[model samples]
Target: MKSHIYITRHGESQWNVECKVQGITDTPLTSKGIEQAHELAKKIKESGIKIDEILHSPLSRAADTAKIIAEENGLPLTLEPRLVEQNFGEYEGHEWKKYPGVFHEAKKQFACDYNGGESMLRLGQRIYNLLDELKVRSEKENKTFLLVTHGGIARMIHSYFNSETNEEFSSTNTGNCEIKEYVF
Candidate 1:
């Protein structure tokens, strides 16, 4: 049986609007974010996509988006910690523009850790594990599901599906509630 997976990043948060880094710290969605989510719900409903189950990162932002979708679709929500954002370590709450060399540093051959946070490779492994779990679950249930996660997590998923080439797979500009369809 074939199954479809819809992946999306959470809506904008206060930190996002403030132009601050939000790796591990939890932040509430902005009013505009709530509105965007509502709009997203309407679009998904109108698209006639069949969603059987919903999974989400346990982070407040991602989980909140999943809750909204689940509430609207009358489905159960599963929290998957593996879907959480990359641990930014010491870079957790800094302003992106102010963080010198952050972009270049991330792409180094030997990925750096954010002191007290996880390394990119570590995060990638976690994401891979989560996808494996989802694949098994999808095969067993023979159903479509949605995963609500962070931009970083979304990038990891995209990279995985795209075969993890050296090409950059950045999701920094992914819009809130933007849905990506994956079929297998």
Candidate 2:
């Protein structure tokens, strides 16, 4: 059988509950986030997709969620620094709603670095590179990987697999613990 790549966003974090922009700011998961991880694990197991390995961001929220899934599925996991969420710099910990204009403007200017954070182009380069490498490795080794990451990273992962419009790429975000698959 052909190999595939599976991607999932981490469960909700305390920052998420308070409507803060998580970016690369590490935060702990909420109680509901813990439950959601378990639920995601059950869903994956029931779907019967054999995950050969789990690659997770080192951020606590994503790491914790991936650990749960790894435990449930009896799969090994590796930390992937490239899978970490894009750093939002000045926007970190701020409510997204209040700063909609900044984000919207940043979306159009792909090179905008948010005064210190990774530019969209930079994020795309790393994410696309990671996916390209994974695709090659998956085909050569016949291994499937599950990437546990954050919402910003999730958007990039989807773009790696799909030809997304600029609008879609700018606006897309995955739900907490939502699993997405890409065939190799």
Regions more than 4 Å wrong, model 2? none
Q: For candidate 2, write residues 79-130 as lDDT tens digits.
A: 9999999998777887877776667556657888888989889999999999
**Model 1 ranges off by over 4 Å:** 107-110, 164-167, 171-173
Candidate 2 weakest lDDT stretch, 10 residues:
100-109
Tens-digit per-residue lDDT, 117-184, candidate 1: 78778888998887877788888977788999888788777776776544355423466889998865
Count of backbone collisions in candidate 2? 0
For model 2, name the residue pairs that clash.
none
lDDT computed for candidate 2: 0.90
> 34, model 2: CA deviation in Å?
0.4
lDDT of each: 0.79, 0.90
Q: Check candidate 1 and list the clashing pairs.
A: 89-114
